[model samples]
Target: MVKWVLALVGYFIYRFPGAIAGYLIGTLIDSSFESNKKSGRKGFDTVFTTSRSQNVSPSDFELNLLSLASIVIKADGSVSQTELDYVRAYFVQAYGKERANATFKTFNDVIKNREVSAQRICTYLNSRTRYEVRLQILHFLFGIAQADGRVSSPEVSQLSSIAGFMRINQNDFKSIKAMFVKDANNAYKILEIDKTATDAEVKKAFRTMAKKYHPDKLQHMDEAYQKGARDKFQKVQEAYETIQKERGF
Candidate 1:
């Protein structure tokens, strides 16, 4: 039915040149919805736009840290080396080698520091990046996670949390998350509990996860294992928060 309607509209445009003008005007009106949402400019101002302001600043650690969380999401509730490697590559490009390496190392330290919370990651980034840039960064994360042609539940859960921290609309977040989930399993599924899990359950899960991925255990393994452990551990914390929102606890 929609296709038929579109075909009829096309025929009308083909028959009447004046219809082309009307069609263009309609397209402009339709596009205004998105523009209005972006600029917070409404019916009148959008029609007669004034000089627009622009801000170009690099995204802060918060954005990077949250983006890093997306890669840490896994199928078995354990992040894999593939995810860590992706993060390393991303920061290397985003921050450049030397600064990116230092920033990456500092982020790992912060995750391991046991003094900072995942919440701080968003707070820090929110302070540093423009609202539009934060959204773009979040979307870019979805792109990275999907680059391998597969996305897991843990990643989706983390993406949802990051979106929440950014105050992104639920509908919009779902739309973006959907773009990356081309295969089976999702972040919520890997967590093995619904969003409605009780606070006690969340705590229990976090503790079990805490012991499993603790960097301390990986210290005797190899440098790679030890280096990745802390970041993976931080992901466990993020997973717990994802559950928290579902339960409203």
Candidate 2:
């Protein structure tokens, strides 16, 4: 996070003395991290898991997710480096860098080489995780698919299969899908409504979806996780506003 802030500040002040300030601060922060590297490694366990992300242990969740991610990356019959980096970056942002590094070491050394069963993984998750968390995971997967610019047909098909295994509702799945795939009726699709629905029904659907995708559903996770959740929530808001503007309501 500090790295991002320093980079942003440096970008804005590239021609000014403020860039010097950012560089100095980043140097100090980097040195501090180097000195505390041992403690950071030792402290990975505490930040790796939160008691609030369902009853699934951190290791279990990380393993299952990496397995699924590997499947998604291979779905298009070709792997893209951008997609791989998106997954790595997401983990680094959501968990601290130390724990994310340990998890990815497992991912590269073991999980990526195995044939994982989506059925077993989803069954475990479906039984253990809440609907909201499952939805968030689906959203994350879609983000991965879109990382390389477009969500391909094969990736969407793979995601659909995964969502089915996870017991995600078709309408709910479509709602998230519409966020990535542009279409004329995306606003209606996002709220799980139809163009023929009455204005009252549109308003009702807005409220329903607003509650479903609210960022508070992910309050227990990292701010990065909640920020991702807010993307969905914000999509719902934008969809509703789009409909209202169209209908002049």
Note the Cα lDDT for every prediction shown.
0.49, 0.77
> Per-residue lDDT tens digits of candidate 1, residues 1-249?
222322344445455553454344334433543454587532222221213432212222323453345334342355445655676776565445654454344344333222333456666455544444444456666655665657666667767777787776675465345435532323343244445666787577667656755677544322433445555556556666666675567
Error of 1 at 211 (Å): 46
For candidate 2, write residues 1-249 as lDDT tens digits.
333444455556453454555555555444544554545532222333334544444445665787788878878987788988898898888766765665565346333445678788888777677788889889999998999999999999999999999999999999999999999999999999999999999999999999999898777676667888999999999999999999999
Candidate 2: regions farther than 4 A off: 1-54, 109-112
Sliding window of 10 residues with minimal summed lDDT for model 2:
41-50
What stretches of model 1 exceed 4 Å from their correct place? 1-76, 106-116, 147-149, 183-249
For all predicted structures, in order, the TM-scores are 0.41, 0.77
Q: Global CA lDDT of candidate 2, please?
A: 0.77
